[model samples]
Target chain A: MGAIYKRELSGYFNSAIGYVVLAVYYFFSGLFFYLYCFYRDSASLGYVFANMFYIVMFIIPVLTMKTFSEERRQKTDQALLTSPVSLTEIVLGKFLGAFTIYALCCAIFLVYGVVISFFAQPQWSVVLCTLLGMLLLGMAIIAMNIFISSLTESMVVAAVVGMAAGLVIDTMSSFSKLVPIPWVQFVLEKIDFLNYYTNFTYGILSIVDVIFFLSVTGLFLFFTVRVLERRRWS
Target chain B: MIEVKNLTKRYGKITALDNISFTVDTGEVLGFLGPNGAGKSTTMNIITGYISSTSGTVTVDGSEILEEPKKTKQKIGYLPEIPPLYIDMTVRKYLEFMFDLKRVKLPKKEHLDEVMRLVGLEQHGARLIKNLSKGYRQRVGFAQALLGNPPVIILDEPTVGLDPKQIIEIRKLIKSLGKKHTVIFSSHVLSEISAACDRIIIIADGKIIADAKTDELSGVLTDKRQLLLTAEGSAADIQNELKKIPDVQKVKKTGESDGAAQFAIEYKPGADIRRDVFSAMTRLQCPILEMRSGSESLEELYLRLTGSVKGGEA
Candidate 1:
């Protein structure tokens, strides 16, 4: 697992993918950070994170597109699958490598929080909770996208499918608002990931929201492992 | 040692392998021979635990592969039809990664040096695998398979794309490895198996059509030999004279040539009619000028079995 993790991390830097993702992500994120907080004179970091979550609809595809699709397309999966390592190690290694880059990007959000502290008193605990929420959100997206990547051999298809899936997950309830019953609406609202993050911006670390994010992430990663294993039997 | 029992693999309606079973004893190099798309690769993939068989099982050294995949896989090294390589990595780094993947117990520093030297990749170790030539990439794949010194090595078409020099180099390497390991490798080339393996398994249409020791395969499949004769007589006289010998099945007279009649004599199954013909010709005083027997070659036998062979150059 360590060997695969190191190789995947190095692969990210060598292909310039890690840098490209960070640059594109930060450019848009910094733009929103400046627009909502600095120029507008607002104390809400929630705006920056909310917009960043949407921004992942675009850039996360770029980061995770080649994770497993390129390996299959280039026929490198043969080397990986024939090795003695268990399937779990291969999936976990890739997940951590991708998540590491994501955590690095999310850490940069700390600069926004620190810069805000110079002005009116900022809530450090809320910023910490929001960062944790952001990490969980990114984990869930990475898990979901890795599964999409494993399904196709074309990088373009993987990237496009990832973006589409992210769009549906993020905007799913906006369309599902057509449901009539209040109970149905309540259940559908739970599916809206951004709706859960509303608690973190106000300094309340909602347990249900944390559990929801972690469960979604776990479910997708579990499916990704199954998808790879299914190929062997097929 | 390996034993495959009633192993079958089906991709939907197409059965890639149809209940094929065979066993290789310890220290035996079993040659897997088949025409294109003959399920040889599928069988190897199942045996190596790269894929699951739809039905039946593979046992290596008394351990069932599916039940104890990690332990069974630990003892096997597999190279698929295409050499599996990480083109982005340097040869040295790839080998190091494979060492970890195979869970090699030896220290990396020691095993890396030995494997690099074994596959003759020391000079080219620093180069990215994508930049290396096809033949070198193949060697690195082979080196990774040999990293842990597994008891069983299954190589698919190892020499397919190599130049003549590289082909001889790899065949020699496989031969040397066979001295210690139970090697089950596949090829469409008849001469390669005839030269390298203790036994050969011939597969066709997803079935074990022929399986025998290398010499025995040739002996069973192509035992017939034709004898050519020239004599100072009419064609009918030579034909009549040749048929009187025991075990001589057919005698056909072509035409008179160069003041002698030419006749072709064929022997019955497992028969040696040369001595009988020699004595009969000497007694008749017909003055035999020449005699030739048909040869049973691996090429001829392969052609006879597969039927699509065109002079065997490919």
Candidate 2:
């Protein structure tokens, strides 16, 4: 598992995709920081972190589009799958590989938080909470994309589907608003990732919210392992 | 040793492997001979724990692949049809990754060096796999499989895309590996199987049609023995003289060159009329210039067995 993790992480940096994803992610992140903080004279960094979710929606797909699809296409999965490693280990290794890259981009967001502190002394607690929220949200989304990546051989298909799935999850809050039934709307809003993420921007750290994010991440990783196991039988 | 029992695999409505069973003793080189879409790869995949069978079990050294996959897989190294190489990495990096993936606990440097040397990739370890030629990439894939020195090695079409020289070299490497490990390789080419394997399992249409020693398979497919004799005589006179030999069922004139007639003398089952034919040819004034027997080569038998749709099972 450690070997697969290292190989997968190195694979991203060895190609142009890693650099391109980071550059595109930070460009928008910097742009959003400028628009929400400097140009508008806002002291709080919540808007910058909040808007960053939109950028994450796009970058997560690129981060995960080739996780398993490329291996299958190149026939390299045979080496990994036939090895002594269990299916759970293979799934976890790949999930962590993509998460590390996502985390690097998030780490850059922390630098932005520091730069903002030098200017306006934004609330440290709020910034930390939002950073935690961003990671949880990103972890769950990355897990979902890895599962999508495992289902196809073409990277394009994985990317497109991942992007679509991300968009659907991100917009679930508004989609729930359109529902007429109060109880149904309540359930959807509770499950909507944006609803859970919005709380951290205001320094809201409910145990339920953390559990929700963790559960989503765990559920998707488990599903990914099941899908891979099912492939062996198929 | 590897043991497979009644392994059957199905894809929706079609059965890919139909109740197939075979075993490979330790340190034996076994060949899976079959045409395309004949379930050769499917069986290899099952044995290596890369996939599961629909209704059967594969055991490696008494560990069931499904129940104890990690233990069974640790005992096997599989090279699928296409060399599964991460093209971006150098050969050395790729091998090191494989060692780690296979959980090799010993010192990595020495084992990797030995594997690289064995596969003739010692000097090219620094080059990225994408930059290497196909033959070199294949060698790297072969080198990856040998990393942990597993007890069982499964290669699916190991020489499919190599040049003639590389093919021969890979065959020799496989033969050498057989000295210490149980090897099972699949190929549709009869000559490759016959040359490299001690036992051949001939499969057609998802079923094992024949399984025996290389020479014995030819004997099983052939019911009658034949001799090709070139005699310096008229075609009709040579045919009549050859017909006079007892147990000679049919004598046909196949060709005539320079006034010498080539006759195919087919004998009844379990008959050796070579000396009698020679004496009769001497008496008939038809000097026998050339004599060749055992007309049924493994190649012909393979064609005969696989060509027929109703090719019987062994």
Candidate 3:
């Protein structure tokens, strides 16, 4: 697992995808930071994070799309599957590899909060909670995309399907608004990831929301391992 | 040692492998000979635990592959037909990654250098694998399979697209590795298997048609006799005389040069007509220049057993 983790991490930087993802993420994120904080004279970092979450919906797939598809396309999976490493290790190593890059990009956004604090008295605890929420959101989305990559050999298919899935998850809050039923609306609110994310944006660190994100991430990672193991039988 | 028993695999309606079984002892090289789509790759995939068999078992070193995959996989090194290389990585880095993948207990600092030297990749260690020639990439594949010094090596078409020189080099490498490890390699090339392997398993349509020593496969498949005769006579006269011999199946006028007619005499099963042919040539007053008895070559035997050619009375 350690060896695979190291190799996959280096693979991202060795190619152009990693840098492209970072540049796109910061470019849009810095733009939102300027518009929300400077142009509108608002000190609340939550608005910037709320808008950045939508941008991440598209960018995380770029990081995770080639995780397994490229290996399968090049036939390198032969070397990997025949090795002594277990299926769990292979899946976990890739998840962590993509997660590391996502975390690094999100960490850079900490500068936005620090810069806001110098000019106006922003809520540091609110910023911290929002950052934690952003990390969880990224984790859940990255894990799901990794699973999608395992399903196909074409990188384009993985990316497109992953973007579709991310789009549905990111916009589920709006989806709840379109449904007017009281009971269905209640369930969709529970299932809507953005509603859960909204609580952290206001400095509410609910344990239920944290477990919800972790559970979604774990479910996808587990599914990815099963998909790989099932391939041996097929 | 490796043992496969009653192995069967089916992809939907198609049965890829049909209850095939074989064993390879320690220090033995087994060649899997078959035509295209003959379940050669399927059998290898099951043994390496890369895929699962629908039923039956494969055990390596007394442990079942599915039951104890880590131990079984650690003992075997597999090179699929495609070589399974990361083209972006340098040769040295690839080997280091393999060492970790195999979970080698020894430090890989000097061991990798030694493997590089073994596969003749010492000079190309710093180069990316994609930049190297096909032959060099093949050598890198061999180098990775030889890493961790596993006790069993399974190669699938290790010399498919190589030039003659590269083919011979890879064959020699496989031959040397067979001295210590149990090796099983698959190929459709008859002469390659006949030259490199100790035992041969011939499969056609997912069934084992013949399994014997390298020298015995021809003898097992063919029982007819072919005699080449060179006699100083006219082609018509020689043909007439050869036809008189009993049990002669087909006699073809092979060549004629300098008042000599060469004919190939194929005999029916259970017929040793050499004595009759000799006496008939002597009575015709034609001097016999050369006479040699031979069986069918391995190539012909392969074609016949694979159902590409129809078999005769024997």
- Note the Cα lDDT for every prediction shown: 0.84, 0.88, 0.88
Best-fitting candidate, measured by lDDT?
3
lDDT of 1 at B15: 93
Q: Give the per-residue lDDT of model 1 (tens digit) for B1-314.
A: 89999999999999999999999999999999988898999998889887889998899987888788788888988888787788888898888888887888988888888878988998998899989998998999899889888999999999998998998888888899899899999999887877788899989889987789988976775556687877775566557778888888888775687678877787887777878887777777778888777555544565666666574342
Q: After superposition, how far is residue B254 of candidate 1 from its true place, in Å?
A: 14
Worst 10-residue lDDT window, candidate 3 chain B: B305-314
The fraction of reference A/B contacts recovered in model 3 reads 0.79
* TM-score ranking of the models: 3, 2, 1
Clashing pairs in 3: none
Runs of candidate 2 exceeding 4 Å displacement: B218-299, B303-314
Give me the displacement of residue A135 in model 2, in angstroms.
0.7
Taking all chains together, each candidate's TM-score versus the true structure is 0.85, 0.88, 0.88
* TM-score of predicted structure 2: 0.88
- For candidate 3, write residues A44-88 as lDDT tens digits: 877889898888899988999998999999989999999999999
Every model's DockQ: 0.47, 0.72, 0.69
For residues B1-314, what per-residue lDDT tens digits would candidate 2 score against the true structure? 98999999998899999999988899999999988898999999888887889999898989998888888899998899988899999999999999999998779999999999999999998999999998998899899888789999999999887899999999999999999999999998877887788889988777888888877864665576889999898888778877888899988777899989888788887888999998988888888899989566555666676664353322
Q: Between candidates 1 and 3, which one is better according to DockQ?
A: 3
Give the per-residue lDDT digits (tens) of candidate 1, residues A159-207.
9999998888777668669878888888878788777776776667988
